[model samples]
Target: MISIGHSPDADDLFMYYAIVFGWVGDDLEEKFENQALDIETLNIATIQGIYDVSAISFGAYPFVRENFALLQTGVSFGDGYGPKLIRKKTTQLKKNFRVALSGVHTTNAIIFRLAYPEARIVYKNFLEIESAVISGEVDAGVLIHESILNFDTSLEVEREIWDIWCEKAQEELPLPLGGMALRRSIPLNKAINIESTLTKAVEVAVKNKKILSKMLIERGVIRVDEKELDIYLDLYANKDSISLNDLQKKGINKLFELGFKAGIYDVLLECEDYFIPTGYQALRNS
Candidate 1:
């Protein structure tokens, strides 16, 4: 009886769960019977113990640390989905500049600081940031989530913060887009099994080509272009990259470096047995 929570951007993986977890036909009603609300709402509701597993943004790390006991691991959309430093198509950042973000404590804010340490960062909602950038409220804005896909290219991409991280780290670092995490109350063995199951499901979905295409079409999150969907899935559904060990050590280290450089966090919070040893080895071998 796992109560899973995620954002709308994760609908494709949710649909895969609907198929693999026997929730698609008459079982759909039973599977999500206890779902409190949408992913964002449910994550907020985590303070009330409404869910055991959650998919949360990296920007929510500070909140999660203060509010919950959980382990962060699993599949993510990768670094490409990180915040983009954008300016007007004609504008450029010569020296220091003012940057608008979705929120002060949001993930984009953290990424913006890491990428442009010299810039002045301001907070704004997603819609407001778009308007602000266009209206010249700020010199540039950091965009995230669906905004990356839906953004009007009239705004030029100054730099992708994740791309910068990749260049600096010299590895294809997972940008903690979001992934499944379990509360401390859940048994450790059960959490391991669930993680293994999800890893396998993603692999199967990736291989099945047809299922991946159908999922994108059914969700309407993206247009009905197989090539586009393929690219998205390939970027997000990285089978070998989803493991507790990599996320805890490699992934967390990279994020910590970014956070420290950006001044969003002081240091990475340590966790015990954060990675499953066998799973880590398998990912390495693959």
Candidate 2:
């Protein structure tokens, strides 16, 4: 049995897996009997599974590299809709602003620091970020995940950090959204099989819009409109092809450089080991 962990944002992959793996039927029993896949929410604590894939962020990369082995690469989701630096319209920002993040050690926080070195960042769960921004607890908020879609309109978008990275790099950098990975102990064939299955699953999901939409709603993780989600899934999913050369590596490298410039990562070489290039030159060139 293989155990895969990923963030809530990666629910699309899970939905695709269910569709392609024959794991969903009129009832749950038939689904489970037909498919031998298991999935769970990824966290820092669950890094030791025999076969593990994670939606690694900046903070998680250090942990994954220190613990797991590199495996096949996956598609890039592109720089996320750009993390929103939101502030209450009434708030004054004469001084360096205070910001709230999902976690201080998360990729969002690192990107925030790289984009605004002088700002103060604090940790809060997703629920608290918008409230903090609106109630004056924080002058600005760095929002990710579904929070990007659910953000209150009253708050103003001061800047998009990923846009800054794009400007600096002069290319559309992949935001290192997430990928499939395996534990060092897994048999190489098993890992390859899992990758192949997942890639095909994604393709199936893309073709079956009804199943994909139902999966998203059932999961309750996506707050965006169905049209938007459809567009996103179509753009990001191409299961027949797997490439690591896109924005994921380049965007990550850019982020690493920014992290070094901002003094967020103490050892740059350590960060370098976290990126494993998958051999798809088209993705690299794109």
Candidate 3:
């Protein structure tokens, strides 16, 4: 059995249910067990080499590079929008403003740190961030996942993480948020088969989006209402998420570069160099 870890958000639910529903990879002999958790928990778990496959922040990849190979499919990117920094009142932030971030290792936290280096930081679950801000536990908070869409009226926009990412990037690229990673400890042939199965799962999910979304709603698996879930899937789990294209690859590399320059990671990583070597399977079959 292969264990998989993914977030409980709508986008992840949308991408992963194709596999859960047995819509893909029927020929594969491996059985998958899925675990739904918050992204921060999964990130920390990936660092420990806990799951055979997992969804992780792109920002967390460098730290887990030794044990995990980034998967080509099931990626989330922001074209011109992403995590939001919200405040209870519209006021100028002090140099040492207290901020609640989803996690220390999240992509939003990495970008937010670069943008506001002097801010005091605290870690909170994405679900608790809005309440943290409303209750004034922190002066501001960076909202990730679905929280980006449905914030309370009492809260106001402080900034967008995408704006910070754009400011720091060398060229315009989609903001890399999260993607799946496979444990490198798995045998190469099995890893290739698993990757192929997952790639097909993403494709099938996108093709059957409406049917799948209805099923998810009926099952009460998602947090948002049907309309909100539809919008969330369009933003994070569309066809572009099926695999890494050239542009998405560049975007991920740029994010790694940014992290390296900021001293968040010791070495710069080329996104493609770390992927599972599926071509070996082709060579073997040839």
- Give TM per candidate: 0.70, 0.73, 0.98
Q: For model 1, state the Cα shift of residue 132 in Å.
A: 4.5
Predictions in order: lDDT: 0.57, 0.56, 0.92
Q: Whose TM-score is greatest here?
A: 3
lDDT (10s digit) by residue, model 1, range 1-99: 567665454333532453444533232222332242333454455645566666655455545554444443444645545657788988877667988
Which residue pairs overlap in candidate 3's backbone?
Answer: none
Tens digits of per-residue lDDT, candidate 2, 1-286, equal 3455544453345334553346433222212112222222243433544335554454445445656644334443444464677888777665468888776555656666666778777878756789998888888887665566556878988877667657655677666544455565545444445555655555556566566666666766565667666655554454422545544655666766666666766656333354333333336458
Which rank order by TM-score, best down to worst?
Answer: 3, 2, 1
Q: Give me the displacement of residue 74 in model 1, in angstroms.
A: 3.5
Give candidate 1 regions above 4 Å deviation.
Answer: 10-50, 62-73, 77-82, 92-96, 103-107, 117-132, 135-137, 166-174, 219-226, 241-249, 258-263, 270-272, 275-286
User: Which numbered prediction scores highest in lDDT against the true structure?
Assistant: 3
Runs in model 2 with CA error above 4 Å? 10-16, 19-43, 46-51, 70-76, 168-170, 218-221, 231-242, 266-286
